[model samples]
Target: MRTQVAIIGAGPAGLLLGQLLHAAGIDNVILEQRSGDYVLSRIRAGVLESGTVRLLDAVGAGARLHAEGLPHDGFDLLFDGARHRIDLAGLSGKHVTVYGQTEVTRDLMELRAGQGALTVYEAEKVALHDFDGDAPYVTYLDRGEQKRLDCDFIAGCDGYHGVSRASVPSRALKTFERVYPFGWLGLLADVPPVSHELIYAGEERGFALCSMRSNSRSRYYLQCALNERVDDWSDERFWAELRRRLDPATAEALVTGPSLEKSLAPLRSFVAEPMRFGRLFLAGDAAHIVPPTGAKGLNLAASDVHYLSEALREHYAERSSAGIDAYSTRALARVWKAERFSWWLTGLMHHFPDHDGFGGRIQQAERAYLISSPAAMTALAENYVGLPF
Candidate 1:
């Protein structure tokens, strides 16, 4: 098999990239280790920045998203039983939509199918070859047969634990990472959401987030010990813990139900410098990871793809490498800004294990200042809705 680009992973990042390239008449092939159903079944973040929404629309996959996604102008920051609102749309001239990552992947996959794009699911032991010297190719096993896909370039969109970044020589990779002391014990339920917009609550116990996948699907999370497990949290217990962290009014309005899914996710802020290794480029989780506090994970991936797709388009359309040469710098600049926002937000909301009363007071004071000062609120609002592409 031969193509212009051989993409690893069929997650949102890979699928979105394929859609963009295919829309531009670029031939690319996507390889995934998992079945299509399994890919769509995985639950992930639901927030959509305006830039991401626009990208989906550009690829002709936003019909269902716009029809079903919940749009919000602002979200609330709760501390000491008080609610502080950040007018996201008013402050930044943009707002976010509540649309699941799963839905986005589904949209892209369906679009790919409709467009006759090539996607090989259940490709096993996939590996890249000769990416650094041009004439790159990918090899994998399929149905007991070894297959090779030759391509001009490769995109490593598999994820953090994916092979693309790991394939790079360690000597050339500079990694920066911080693992938070705790994790977010998240639960998804079919209950109606307590509020129309998300709420980030800081409490004496820990941090809690009130977000939703839709009107009838509420997703909640509580800061938990890193060692905690899903088996440790019952539906009733999770709801009770979440209620303890929220304001009294929100807690009173909160609805409870059997959880559809429960999982523990460790918080980490990670970035791999220079996102490019010869003919291979990293996008999304392959290059960086941010704590969910800022809701930047999926949006950041879109931005990376946005930059990458544009560069590839320029290379093919104008016979230029200028955008390709500038891709890493442009993507990394945005990556660091998102990393900073997620880091700051995580620090402000979570209860650190080693934090003294003084540290806790500092966090509260920062939150207080953020809500009181227009400049501070504007900054938060802009980051929340996502900085410009």
Candidate 2:
């Protein structure tokens, strides 16, 4: 097989990159190790930055998102039984949309299929070959037969565990990592959201987030020990903790249903420098990952591919590799800023055993400062709503 770009992984990054390039009259192929159904149904990020929404709309991928996605002008920061609203629109002149990543993937996959883009699913032995040569190739097992795909460039949109990053020389890659002492026990319940806006509650019990995937389905998470096990948490215990953390004075209308899904995601921040080497480039989780506290995971991945697509377009049109060469530095500038914001939000909201009363007071004071100070609030709003791509 021959193409201009061989993309590994059919996640948002790889799939979107192919779509964008295809729109620009570029030829590309996508490879995935999982079935299309599995890729479209994976439980992932749920919040979309305003910039992400605009990008989707511009690319004509927001038809269903515009109709089904929920828009929130602000979010609630709860402490000591009181709620403070950070008016996102007032602070940044923009708002966020609550739509699951699965929906985005499904929409993109449908769009890709309509456009007749080639996507191989459940392909095995996916490996990058001759990435440093003039013609890069991706080899995999399709239908129990070995196949080699040749392309001018390769994109590693696969997750952190994929072979895209491993193809790089170990000595040339610089990795930075920080693993938190806690994780989040996330649950998806078939219930209506308690509040219209996302609620970040910091209580004496723990940290809880009230977010929605749709009008009829809600998603919530609670801070827990890093070593926590899903088998250890029961449905009753989960709901009780959620209630204690999101304790509201007034009895709001809420319908509790069985948790359809439950899992624990360990909090961590990881970044690998130089997202490109030779003819191969990395985008999204393949290159970096952030804690979900700031809700920047999916948006960041989309942003990475946006720049990469632009660079590839420039390379094809102007025969200039300048944009592609600077891809890493340009993308990392935003990556580190988000990393700091996610770290700050995670540290401020989550309760740690080592934090004494003094520490608790400090966190409360920080929260107070963020709410009362316009400058701080504006900074938070900018990071939370997302930066321009």
Candidate number of the best TM-score: 1
Residue 13 error, candidate 1, Å: 0.5
User: What is each predicted model's overall lDDT from 0 to 1?
Assistant: 0.93, 0.89
lDDT per residue (tens digit) for residues 62-123 in model 1: 99998999999999988889988889988989999999999999999999999888899999
Q: List, residue by residue over 1-389, the lDDT tens digit for candidate 2.
A: 89999999999888888888998888999999999988877898789998788777766799999899998899988887888899999999989999999998888899999988899999898999888788789999998999999999999999989999988999989999999888899999889988888888888888899889999899989999987899999988898778878756512454567999999999999999989898999999999999999999889888998889999999999999999999989999998999999999988888877898999899989998998899999999999999888
Q: What is the C-alpha RMSD of each candidate to the true structure, in Å?
A: 0.8, 1.3
Per-residue error (Å), model 2, residue 126: 0.6
lDDT for model 1 comes to: 0.93
Worst 10 residues of 1 by lDDT: 363-372
Q: TM-score for each prediction?
A: 0.99, 0.97
For model 1, the stretches where C-alpha displacement exceeds 4 angstroms are none
